[model samples]
Target: MTGHHPRQAVVTGSDSGIGAATALLLAAEGYDVGLTCHEDTAGVRATAAAVEERGQRAVVEVFDASRPDAGATVDRLAEQLGGLGVLVNVAGTGHTDRVVDLPYERWRQVLATDLDGPFLCAQRAARIMIAGGHPGRIVNVTSVHEHLPRLGTAAYCSAKAGLGMLTKVLALELAEHGITVNAVAPGEIATPMTGIAEEDAYREERPGNPVGHVGHVNEVASVIGFLVSPRASYVTGASYVVDGGLSLMAAHGHDSATGWRSLS
Candidate 1:
């Protein structure tokens, strides 16, 4: 493997939320991480500092995975960091509004970041890891919406679903090369990106998921950590769900979040 001791793991959109949590956890597990903050320098530095605290190396980089220049950006970062081994594609965007009401530009923007960005990042990372002749792991951060449909989020749901299939295809294609590809499809997770705080009117108005609440960033990151770790060497081409069983909970008529446990 390429630089396993200082374990190089590149995580996109790592400035905050699940990306940040994942990097911090991976670093604590002895993986030196390459972190990308779209524009959150302070948050990025904080994440890097946490990685350093774990006695692992951390490199913070400015990266916009959605851009056409993603390949070059990743290449430069990999070269500077010595060798790239693990890739966590956590960069994405979401959408709101019914499909008909959604603007064409907005739809394109969501797909560009959520689907295209991860594809680009993974392709570049795969090339480096394969060329280095290292056993590599690539994990795409998908969503519960990958399989479950959500109203007013047609673009997000569609892109995520496609990303899931892409994960499977990539896994199949890369199996011969010793690179593992998988996805972590999380449900409603508590994060800054979701605009999901108790103070948010939208959240307050729409309080509670089928599980009575949403998941935490760490909850999603932990599974991703395991998937990219050596412990999951045999695991690939899979999309693990961390939705607090909400995906399976048919609580459509059960509107109240407090009624989660009453399903049984």
Candidate 2:
């Protein structure tokens, strides 16, 4: 069942990082992009300008992914873009507190933002695509923690793991409708979230990572671009890890770690 997926796309959390890069890449690929930001108004506007400079339509919206009403923002953006064909769920949050010290509110906040938000947004996007009688793409930006547990990121890891499973389940359910759902799991990347500048990505070296240097936002965006492209129409329910082999070092990371029991 092949259907024409529209070139219109909505990217959540496009103010910076991977989301921003993705919006630009999709624009370069002839997609009219709908970009959403949480708190960085200026950053999102700057991204929108860059998209327009790429000669594609860009719409900016303030989106708080943790809110229950977040899906409405996707609806509005899809309507503004004329219809929905691609939806990237990139808005996410993380917590560093261990489970013993993690507050319930913080746990809920992380889950709501990283997991519930994507579910709601994807639900809305899928309905629109189905109603339009066209195939679509939904990309969830998960973390390497989705597959590997970390020391102090209990909430974050749980949410991402849940999202990874959600992607597979959605793929199975939506295949008949001609929609493809997948996840992109990234390791440490040079973005504002990591407090690393893009120019410094190569300067920072991770001996544990096979790639040696931290990943750039464009690197991850390129993978996402291919997934949304017509070439990936048959691909779904897969989690593409963009981590520089960081997750692969799980055993190595714990080999000499006798202090792993303490959070400090």
Candidate 3:
């Protein structure tokens, strides 16, 4: 036991956005955190610093979760943490191409990174947690795109939808072992994934969101932190959407002519 503390957690794609927020918040809650950034070295370092600022141990791993060596990469992180207690799958990519024109390669890229990669990481983390005799938490940071579609993002929508299903499958399979699995699906969070700037212009332009602006990375991270905490022991296979009523726009009269209506 670390003596009145949270355990070690590996937060994937934590260089920025929701991933970075998850790392920082988890650290603040007493979890030693391992952060991975696929490409952005600077964001990786920044997140590591944030973790340390919270008085938590931080290890940074450069990882591409889509590659064949992804399992090896996660294993390296597991070694650094001495074991695993929480796995946050947040590393992902986005797209802005039409379904007809969306390159098959791009679809593969998004699926591999967003869905397949997280599946592999969660599987490996589960093995380690079980062998280490720790009942753990696995929180997949999916997107509101999983249900509510957006224009020119077929690959992203498809992949996130798959991730949602994967979360449920894992919850069912890992339940007997006491490993809880859930998802945080955020909409338009101001992160690299959304490629939206955090400025007043963008905020003022978003007229439909009940919160009246795009969500911040920390908003989603707060939900993720809760899902992994001991307080969430009874929660599993569910997704908490932090979209601030943007999804409601679809239910209301907002014309989804942004090209999202055909996803059915």
Each prediction's Cα lDDT score?
0.83, 0.93, 0.84
Query: Per-residue lDDT of 119-198 in model 2, one digit per residue for the tens?
Result: 99999999999999889999999999999999999999999999999999999999999999999999999999998998
Higher-scoring candidate on TM-score, 1 or 2 = 2
Of the pair 2 and 3, which is ahead by lDDT?
A: 2
- TM-score-wise, the better of 2 and 3 is 2
Scanning candidate 1 in windows of ten residues, the lowest lDDT window is 198-207
Off by over 4 Å in 1: 1-6, 197-211, 251-264
Give the residue spans of candidate 2 off by over 4 A: 254-264
Residue-by-residue lDDT tens digits, candidate 1, 139-235: 9999999988989999999999999999999999888778899999988777788867523422433234544566778888899988887788889
Report residue 217 deviation for candidate 3 (angstroms): 1.0
Error of 2 at 246 (Å): 1.2
Candidate 1 achieves a global lDDT of 0.83
TM-score of each: 0.89, 0.95, 0.91
